[model samples]
Target chain A: MNQSMVKVFDIQKDDFISAGEASSSVKKILKQLGVSPEVIKRAVISMYEAEMNAVIHGGGGKGYAEFFKEHIEIIIEDNGPGIENIELAMQEGYSTAPGNIREMGFGAGMGLPNIKKHSDQLEIKSEVGKGTTLKITINF
Target chain B: MEEFINSVTLDKDKCKGCTNCIKTCPTEAIRVRNGKAYIIKERCIDCGECIRVCPHHAKKAVADKLEMIGNYQKAIALPAPSFYGQFPSEYSRKKLLIALKNIGFDGVFEVAAGAELVSAETEKRLQTENFKKPMISSACPAVVRLIQMRFPGLIDNILKLESPMQISAVMARKLFSEKFGISENELGIFFISPCAAKVTAVKSPIGIKKSAVNGVIPISEIYGLVHESLKNTEDDNQTNIFSSDIGVGWAGSGGESNALSSGKTLAVDGIQNIIKVFEQIENDKIENVVFIEALSCPEGCLGGPLAVENRYVAKSRLKQHMEEAKSEKAQIKPVLSKAITWSEPIFPSSVLKLDDDVMIALGKIEQIEKIEKDLPGLDCGACGAPNCKALAEDIVRGIAKETDCVFKLRERVRQLASEMIELESELPHTMNRTEKNEN
Candidate 1:
């Protein structure tokens, strides 16, 4: 009686045009699976923020979404420069993004904080120079 | 009152069974089966994309004929704002309305006037901080249905007021009954629509319990009669047109947003374009915009499938109508001062889901992905489905077969031929005695 379906999307560094592709795809899938609208909205916002952060701060990344009967799990992993301080990054308006990226209307430093606000359960594992991996889960 | 699921219907004989409609439908509501195109009832938003795409003129919008007006003691025409764009600029809107009244309607009420009331209400709502960001306009019935079907979460984001058509019909029914000393039931209220969706909206309303309109007539169906009556009809009165210049501007895209006068508003027209913006809205990506005007038809109602004039020419005429559009204040008032909200809330439709049970639907999703992987990914629509993926979904739903895909059918045929060849080498010993002896 196992009930689970998984989808994976590849993210590219500085791929601003396609930053929200994974979140959009996940939204469609959840809708088809009879997931509630409110849940889908939260999943989309959180995933989109993680994706933008990956593209802007983390050099490049991949998005993994697994849907279960009771809850859904999403992971956004990146191999780019990882966050040195998780607490500081989680604060609103505290951004490490370069000034040029800020001009593009993104990198307002709300990425991690916004993701935390929307997701029910969030975990972040980061290695200073190697990468950052985020695991987010939302109850159905 | 016959309960038809959609206003758009098919003329089976004229259909060539082409995939045009199935490919073009924004909701994927159409499928070709048994050499004919058919519409799925729940999924059709009645946007009339099929009517616009059908090559043989097979698709038609089911509308009320003028003859039906004889059934009522009093019949009033609630002309949509877009109705003004159907004629040349020389025809005064006041005259055009008189022509409408001359045909069969006992009275003519401008829906644009109702639109002005709605605009004022929306302006007030925009000031309240409790509303959702990027408040989506619920003016177009098709866009409202689109949100219910695809973007259910945004339903709360949709403006809560009834459309101009509904608001006008209510006001017309009230005013006409009070003015003539006639009962409301005896009064038949009809709307002049530019597209098929409005007809469906009246019949099977979404948010409201019921529509005040009794019938709907496409502008095309009654245009010729109105044109003929325009020659002899005299000016009814100075109060003939109630809507202000901005209200009449609602005929084209950006009109509703323009009527808002202030705030960061965005207008997106055409069904496909609306889908893109809705996707952005779902992602919470669109920033700072307080209101959005989304229309189903390209260039707004002027480009409706049922509209007769070329959109561009009608657009130029619309501008002229706007300039001449009445700026004078109306003398009569019955619920015309503000917009009335819908009685009920819209619930999301689950027609797109694979199954009711999450586990079962998940299993079906896996099957669809597996089947899609085997497909050629051509999206050719030769299989009577919109694309290979659609065919896969249908297969998992048990409505279609793998052989429905021509490539898959060919592969199956090749496999069967090879199996037959293998069977030829396995004849019984009695029938293959010479071969057995050689072995």
Candidate 2:
């Protein structure tokens, strides 16, 4: 919430190699900040996978990150075809990624599950055709 | 334990300070500082991803050399079960042992025997006390360290059995000293490592006081010697070379699964694959899975860092060796028992902590919030963290500060832009003189 040190990133869809780029930068920052390994790991996993989802399914997205002494917060917003069924998406091994993606070793249907697993707190906002936004926080 | 000395090293000059490894690292063990790479020893799992990806080959693996064994009176070679995968089809076990002796080693022992022993011990432990569900294999030292750092919660799942190499080294020393009437200090044991993590493991063993292994010989360096031995059957290979199918099979993934003969076990290869399985376990999703075998490298020990052949080639060679294993029943019991000792419990160490105190964690949280307000939230590595909040924590640790990132300064510039606009409107006449002076 502090006005001074807020960070922002613009993520693109289908940029596979660059999908986790923003999250990587975030993780580096967290480490230099001397955040506990546990908290930084959680924050990185949540943010990176979420960013990947935006690129893979949401078409493209934007990321916002805020650092606190004890917590790291991340927000991802995408203006793509949003989730039609959040419950189905949450299920393990229920991936909607194309076969090509699977062949590349991703789209295991564990993306959302992984994001949720790593975040201390996670919130998702999506509409079928409108867009989606994800907010994740990890307390150190 | 050797106090968890991280054997993995960083050659800073070659690092481009890119965040590639930082992003890919499962444990966030890598950090780019002052335009080079730095590894946090406490957090590194020695998984070798950075070594695999470093463009400049800056992330080199550190291991003991074969020459180091010369310092001892008697040098012994303890080849891992994966060692068989390095040779050609004609490379006989006796020939390999003979060549090891020729290479100045007094004796050669298969690490598979130790693995067999540990496997038996692990089996017994499973039937007893109510342990963490889906007990993890302790053979892979990298995996053990991974649990120590990132997945400390999963430490309960780590089987308490000592690594086969460790057990083998101890046994080799004991048996050789007893037969030869030599002092223990005069005997040297060198593990032919499949990967760098194993080398690190022996140098700094976990759950034990001192390492039995005095040095490590990377499999890659010894491959040529083994190949040469196979070509020259002219030398007498009269020395007895011992091992079994179950023991040798420990070289590849699913070898452990086959050894345990557990119907509910799952074998996952590659560090990334293991990470995925670990996540599933953390979620408690795979409930029926009783045992999990995780290899840091793909295709198990054959895919270790010190290996010479590709994983596929090594796998085929390993398979061929398994099929050729002598199946006499009488040879089974003694070899199985003598090759390994699965009696001792490999207990998990308590490394994971939720927090020293909830109040302290809370206070740190509040400070991070205040720091965030001062940050520009660019999530730039210039500040050395992923985002503003992380920068705040860095400030707490005294590693980084708010102004380290250029984005925050840009925000300040933008904020000042509006103020200058308002000042121009208020004092247009005063600006005219200063503007004329500049012209």
Candidate 3:
């Protein structure tokens, strides 16, 4: 049976007040679907890291979540300066965020690494001059 | 399934179907359905937030009556530590104990003594157990229920010890029965509760199959009687219970953490704040803490809805009482029994589930999301739900309709108007054809 539900959210750059809104909505949907707490927690942490990256690194972005029978996939696409090197970005404590962002206690350089650690699978596609898209999948 | 009994009840006669209670409930256990606020038994934690917020006095905590003491040959009053903070500082601890006797209890047992024992037991467990850090206190029944419903991951962190109320009831029953040579059935152990959650705890205990206390009586119900008895009597015979000031401090916030020696602890009161802290803990944000004392009520048990005194006043009075009684210490040592420890694993209540089946719940979520898109998202609470999302859920559940929202109704009216205009234009063409045929 093809049982799937999809929801999309538009996230704006530097929108500090609503930075976590998308992740919260995703968590709420997962909870309503009666997902286990462990799965929800993993999904939340992965999605939040991706959401923050979209807002902080990318100028503005769109967050999409597709809930399926076996797994949930989250896609974050952003129109900002793309990553020059994916391998370097994935390293822990490696961040290009400005000092101001670091002072806000957010850009500790663990976003991508933490996301990879929590999600079952992570995919990163980016063109240096174009934009970046992160696809995260977490199994139920 | 056994019928679920909740201590918080609604007075239908006084209910105006207001959304205040629904909004205030942390668990979203209350819903305005059929023009009345209904409590979902599985979702309700019996925190009594609705009872405190309702303006019409519709919400009430159902507890045992004072007259029920007549049912037993010997009645023991197991007063919660918070109960001591309800009265004025002029009333001595001996006077309070005597007043309880005058009010119909054969003997008085201080729950603080049990709190002292539990504190000592918890200290020992912290040193011996190799479990998770930041162990949670299970003294507040409301907090335990909240964890069961929302924070199931932290269930293992909750201390498996019985609450001070239960321990006090057991001690009281044993001491009273032995003194009078009466059977357990003939003696009643009643807890003087500071909140509705305690009443529910006594009725249907968590972790344990049954409660040690026979019944629970709200502090508000017996406050007036205790005061009257205090005024009528003279301080001739003085009786002192076996509870130190440290144990009595458990009545207010931070008391449990303070009672424990040499550990990094965090104490949080109020349901919303506790939820935030729990979320942080789940995210691995909080660390280096040995214990966490989370209370559902603001300022701890003193802020319970069933209490007679204001929370701030009670807290100050309790502080003063603690300061004055610092020299006195508990003379009795309680023996901790193995039966009081929880042996079974705690399970999640899963009250947040939309449906029992995952597929059905997923389908419902799609419908709710579709409905939510059309909603104005104003969260005005005009539709009798706490928010637009809740209204969308209610709509999908067939309890509400799209037209219930004013914005949706306006959109429907606009569509009908456009359809009427199209029919009106067609009417002119039909009239011309009829005129030509007649000619």
lDDT of 1 at B430: 82
What do the candidate models score in CA lDDT, each in turn?
0.89, 0.74, 0.85
Error of 3 at B97 (Å): 2.4
**What is the C-alpha local distance difference test score of candidate 3?**
0.85
* Candidate that would win on lDDT: 1
- Tens-digit per-residue lDDT, A22-86, candidate 2: 87667545544445555655777778778878888888979998866567689999998888998
lDDT of 1 by residue, B323-384 (tens): 86655555465466689888886888888888888888888888899999999999999889
At residue A36, what lDDT does model 1 achieve? 91
Encode model 3's per-residue lDDT on A1-140: one tens digit a residue. Answer: 34787889998998877887788788777777778878888888888888889899998799999988778999999998999989999999999999998888778798899999999999999987789999999998
- Tell me how far the alpha carbon of residue A43 in candidate 3 is from the true structure, in angstroms, after superposition: 1.7
lDDT of 1 by residue, A67-87 (tens): 999889999999988889999
Count the clashes in each prediction: 0, 39, 0
Ordered by DockQ, highest first, the candidates read 1, 3, 2
Question: How do all the candidates rank in terms of TM-score, highest first?
Answer: 1, 3, 2
